[model samples]
Target: MGAISVKSKHLLGLKGMDRQDIADILDRAAYWERQPKVSDALRGKFVANTFFENSTRTRFSFEMAEKRLGAEVLNFSAAESSVQKGESIYDTMRTLESIGIDAAVIRLKPTGVLEELAGKLNVALVNAGDGNNEHPTQALLDLYTMRKHFGEIKGLTVSIIGDIKHSRVARSNLWGLTAMGANVAFCAPDTMQAPELEHYAPFVTMDEALQADIVMMLRVQLERHDKGLIRSAEDYREQYGLTAERAARMKPHAIIMHPAPVNRGVEIDDELVECGRSKIFTQMEHGVPIRMAVIERVLTS
Candidate 1:
């Protein structure tokens, strides 16, 4: 647990941020990762969890971070709120604020719903995920994980594979990988790939992407899409999925990563996940500290 020694507004992205902002946050997070010192930096702060979708990882990680920082957390979902009863989402945002919350960490089913709620709330707005658009904090954690592993980020080749169009992780990773000066690459089937994000990445094929310093995989959200997005999980497993053979093609020291709840054989082979080069488990550990950093920076400085 750590305290928020200073107060500040929320940080939604790297946009408009000078290089200093990125360095300080990363430095402080790296410091906290080592010390784990508990402080009342956020004493008396109140944060509300208004997730409109299912998320055990993000919600619980934030709750843990807030609590460790001495903030009170209020948790609930749209199904249990007025939004499910046909009330507007902004109205729901107002209702959450009505409870005198200090910050609102939201994850909604619709894309850009966070931006919609941002205008209406006086409290800080933390976007956990907004449809397939963005998950800023997730991106931050991923960067933190990368930084921890290599100690520097610039010019590092990182490939993220699998269902890009539907993955908030993919979108978030794109922003993060580019912001930190890492060379990013995306690979997937035509139907599942995100629109050419070459502006943010170097643009390489799966074979070429495998020559990365880092290799990450985004989960295939099978339940969310229509039939056309994927022909078959087995077919997908054959082509885009990271198999043991593909792992052999990767850089000798390259680390594999994923944002968990892996489909085992769908997006990545189970063997690679347990391999020595894999950083997937380490990424999960990075979530708590990176989230704590995000909570501290966004809610209190």
Candidate 2:
């Protein structure tokens, strides 16, 4: 196996990142936001997207970011491949690497796959999602969006609600939020509570977290359905979801955010999605530029 080595590569996660790395990348992303239309920073470079799991928004977002930066992108969707018949991700990545692909973004069902793949490959690895482990890019973009609204992340109190335990987004946000000096208070029912965050103080009500500067609601993972987790969707929604009454309780300036594919009437009131308070759209919009920064830094730097 020929190693397509860069000076170094970045994996998508927060555990290994120090404060400087986070700040520097965010500064680069801020520069991306200012460029307006597009740039040719990665011109003539080839990027591979190995999506073992299904994704439209994230895939297209990465594609758009790559194309905008003037990089040629190879999208490998699993449906058309032998992955459906059970192909290993390492082999798939090796196959892509056999060609002239320079970098990779992977979405898989297993935690630590990107880190494992990164060690074996020469190219930079972006963890699109690894099971419910962590979605660092989403959290980065979310923070980037938050910085725009809140001036900076320092001291911003962010309340994330919904399927905390099963959400890669939640795990990532918790890390990013704390790293940025933003205190995070995520709320969810015991069923949806994120157990890994045992050290952090958690609230059971959206109202409790809404008391902060931002309320980041995460989407529940329906794909990992377990009957023991819920008696009924409506019942869960009634008890733990963000509702109109809850929305009204937020600081008028408190920015509302969701990673999206939001279950309406579940994690947020529908009105909050449209109101002036919502930063969800901003978070989505920032994904492309933030990813562009990530690809450029991990590949070129």
Give the best candidate by TM-score: 2
Off by over 4 Å in 1: 1-8, 15-18, 224-226
- Report clashes for each candidate as comma-separated counts: 5, 0
In candidate 2, stretches whose alpha carbon ends up further than 4 angstroms from where it belongs are 1-8, 201-204, 222-226
- In model 2, the number of clashes is 0
What overall lDDT, based on C-alpha atoms, would model 1 receive against the true structure? 0.77
Cα lDDT tens digits, model 1, 98-158, are 8899888888888766775666568898888888777877777778878888988888888
Score candidate 1 by TM-score against the native: 0.92
In angstroms, give how far residue 293 of model 1 lies from its true place. 1.0
For model 1, state the Cα shift of residue 227 in Å.
1.6
